[model samples]
Each structure stands twice: as C-alpha cells, then as structure tokens.
Target: MSLNGKVAIVTGSGQGLGFAYTRELARQGAAVVINDVNADTAAQAVAQIEADGGRATAVVVPVGTTDAAKALVAGAVDTFGRLDILVTNAGILRDKSLLKMTDEDFDLVINVHLRGTFTCVREAYAYFKEHNVRGRIITIGSPTGQRGNFGQTNYAAAKAGIVGMVRTWALEMKRAGVTVNSVIPVAATAMTKTVPYFQKAVEADERGEAMPAFFRHDLGFGTADDVSGLVAYLASDEAASITGQAIGAGGDRLQVWTHPEAATTEYREGGWSYEALQENAGTLFTAETLQSYGEEFLPLPEDLKPAQAAEAR
Candidate 1:
C-alpha cells in the first residue's frame, strides 16, 4: 500500500494493458480514475476495481484533445480530491508500411498516442506543480518505437516521440520533485494479438497453458498483467529517483534502456571537405562498425515458430 491516499489517472484503461495498469495502481492503494472511450468497458473496469476493494471512477471520453485531458484531471480531483500519478496509456495502431500508409492513418495514430499523451501529461503536471505534489508520470512506449518495425510507421513514430517527451519532462519537472519516465512494455494485448508469436501465446493463455519460454525469456513477450508490476513500481514512492528512464518489462525480465547517445564522434578541424571525407570515410564509417537498426527477433525453435513465418521460412 505504498500508494495509499494517492490518486491516479490511467487513460485507455477500459481493458487490456491499460486495464492491467489501473488494476495494479488500485491494488497499490491509489484511488484511480479510469479513462476510456467505451463507457461499458470503463464502467466494467471501475466495477472490477471496486470488487477488489479499491476505489475507482470512470471517465468515458476520447483522450487526444485538450478538453478531454482537462476533463480527466478535473474528474480525478472531483472524484478523489487530488491527482498524484498519471499513466498516459491511451493509444491506437495504424499498421501500414511507409509506401502504403496514408496521411490520415499517420495523423490518427499521432493524434491518439503522441498528442493524447502530451495533453494528458501537460494537464497532470500542471496539477502537480500547482499543488506541490511529487507526482509520477508514466508514459507508454513500444518496441517498435525503440527500434524500427516493419509495418508500424505511425505507431513507432508516436511511441518514440512519447519517450522523447518523457526525457524532456523529467528534466523540467525535476525541480518540483516529480518524476517522469517511459514504460516500454512488450505484452500480449489486443494491439499485439495479431503478431504470430503473440497470437500463439494468446491461444496458449486462453487454453490455460503457459506461454513458451522463448516468448517469455528471449522475446520478452508475455500477458498484459505481467507488465503491470513495472507500472506499479514506477508509480510508487520508491521510484522517486528513477526519472528520465525508459524501463522495459515483460514476462520474466526488466531492463533499463540507455538514453540516445552518439555512438562515435570525431573532431575535424575546419570540417573536412568532400575530398578529405572520402579518404577517411572507409576507416571511420563501415557497414561492420555501425550499430544495429531494429529490434532483435531471435530465431524461434522449430516447434515454436509461428505458422505464417514457418511457412515463409
């Protein structure tokens, strides 16, 4: 009950990963504000939390606008009297390759994931600063954001942008003693159910079977609930010094992702001309010396290979 007497707001928390986040916060003794577009699911989430002997309320609204963000903070204070933690978890996926992705597709994803997080965090931080509350702000990110993904151009951009914002906000909020961090979660939820490996894991879970070790251990994919503990940890008093970090969590693993940094730097007096650069290009920059481009998709064992991928391989 480290979070006892605290109030929290988790957006897009009707179900899936967002729901798990709300439940965990409530379990930690925070009175929670569950925000979702679907009234039914939002109500259901509140009911579930209440049944678990935790206090909660629902705010049913789409979460990308300033109005909705304002309403959520208002809802938290009106319902629970204050806001101490905000999990900007609302997001949507528009999975299309660059060539096939439309402007509408890109904008829609950005509107929800990036703009929604921005508005919500902006409002929540204002409340924290005004009240002198040492608040915790946890923003959601994705593997696709940390590294390039094949067909998630919009998703990657939005999620990566979220982490970028977290780093900046952490610096800005440090004086107020508020912490801001990104949670890069890899879990089997509605958004990931379509992935072959996650599909297999979901099927296994539905059948009351554990996910294969390859997924949990190596791939870092697990049930949504498995990722909730990290969210809860970040929301607790113990995480006060853990700002500006991108922490990854899943089945059996937790990771600290390094902030972006220059891989290699070399000084050139007067900045070498094209002819000088050409002479040094091979020694300084080579295919073998560059960093990796995308997330590692380890080779799945024969029995664990996803069906669609099995056929192709």
Candidate 2:
C-alpha cells in the first residue's frame, strides 16, 4: 500500500529474485513492467500479478542494448502512463577462474550485468529528469563484489562498478530528488543454487524446509523472497532520504556497508618517497590489521554443508 499508484520497472523479472521484487512491488499497488529475455517467463510473471489483482505488463528484451533500455522505459510510460521506480535486477553469471575464463565468458557476463544496468539506469534517469519525477533507482550488487570471490572476476567487477556508479549518481541526482543505491543481496535463487558452498541450503529451500540457522544468520543466505522487502522499501516514499549507500539483506540480517575509505593516514610532508615508505611499511597499515580477503564464512554446521566442502573445511 505504501507504493500505491506508483509505476515500476524491474528488469530480469521473469524469475528468481527479480520475479520476487516485481511481485512485491505489484502487491503494494504498483503497476509493474516485468522484463526478461524469455517471453514465456515474462508472460507468466504478468499473469501471476494479474491473478493477484495487481496490474502488470511484460516487456521481453535482453536489456543490455540502448534500444532495449529505451524500450523498457518507454514500455513503463506507455503502458502505465509514468515511471516512478527502476530496479535494475537483470544479470547473468559466467563463473571461472581468471586463467580458465575466456573472453567470451567475461564479455557475456559483463554485457548482461554491467552494461545492462548502465543502459537501463541511464534511460530511466533520462525519463525521470524529463518528466521531473522524483524517481527511485535501485541497483543490485553482490557480496562477491564487495569481498573478492575466487572465480567471479567479471561478476565482481560489474557489481562493484554498479555500487561505485550509485555513489556518483547519488551526488549528481541530489537536486533532481532521485535516490540511487545498491542492494547487495545474498539469496537462494537460480543464480546461487549451484554454488557448492550453499548446496545443502538450496536443497532445503527447494523442499519447502527452513534454511539452517548457520546459513540464515551466519552466512546471510535465504530464499529470494526474504530480500524483496528491502527492495520494495527502498523504492517507496519512506526511503527518499536513503541514497548513495550499499545495503545488504538476506534472511533475518540487514547490514549497511561502509564506503571505501582510508583506514590509516599519516602526515606526509612531501607525499613520502619510496625509501621513506619502505621504512614505515611496518607501522603504516598496523592500525587496520589487514582487512580479510574474500567473504569470511562463519564455519557452516557440519550437516548443513556439502559433503566435500564440509570435509575440506
């Protein structure tokens, strides 16, 4: 009800977290434009919304092209008469170690996740500025992006870049009353179901069983619907003051990630010569104790981890 009378566009809404986002928006009374590359899934999403007495339409497009982006914004305005929210939820993953990853794999992932978000947000902002609408733009991010992952070079780059863009856009859109922020969500979706680290949790979810406390509390992993409320809240009037932030949500956990900053700074009269830096290297970074690399899992419960992963851990 908080989003009643609003119009929203959620890319990649054919299924998974994207679908959950659109469904939540529609439930709150927004007329949604569900976009996805697959026509069947898009139509199915629209039908589901309509069955629930919520208004929605399907916009089938790849979303990485400017033309596709243009069509999405136009579809929202053309179908619902205006656009108030744009949630860039469409993305793809091609995971491989840096050495094994090919150019095609990297490019494909970047095209869908990074370029797709860029094109969609650019067009959405243009519409907002032209119509003088104080629109909400929610971009998706990932934990792998925040904390480096072993085989997610492209994905991490794209997602981190998205948050970086949000910070800049927040400053630029301040006068326009447009809020842009990144939601770094961890959830059990098609995208994450195959992750060996979460195989057990995913199986439990698929069977309609609750995820173990270790995953929900310690790992911040949960079903897609658990992350939707934050997306909806960020897109509503109440979150107008929130922008330029990277918020994390999954299961019962919510976190506000601090922006990158210098943890230790010392007086440098001449910006420090190499010889002086080498001498002070020991004490320069001592205060922060070297931030941990990769996401720190809190030791999964023995029964909750994949057999091999559990054995390895």
Q: How well is each residue in 1-313 modelled by candidate 2, as lDDT tens digits?
A: 9999999999999999999999999989899999989999899999999999999998999979999999999899899999999999999888999999999999998898889999999999999999999999999999988998989999999999999999999999999999999999999998787778889899999999999888898878898999999999999999999999999999879999999887666898888999988998898867465677788777666777687876786
Which residue window of length 10 is worst by lDDT in model 2?
284-293
Off by over 4 Å in 1: 307-313
- The window of 10 residues in a row where model 1 has the poorest summed lDDT is 190-199
Q: Which number leads on TM-score?
A: 1
| TM-score of each model, in listed order | 0.96, 0.95
Provide the RMSD of all predictions against the true structure, rounded to 1 decimal: 1.5, 1.7
What is the C-alpha lDDT profile of model 1 across 1-313, one tens digit per residue?
9899999999999999999999999999999999889899899999999999999999999989999999999999999999999999998888988999999999999999999999999999999989999999999998889998888889989999999999899889999999999999988887777777566777887787899988899878888888889999899999998999999998888899998888788788889899888989997787756888777777768887678877897
State in Å the error of residue 201, model 2: 1.5
Which clashing pairs does model 1 show? none
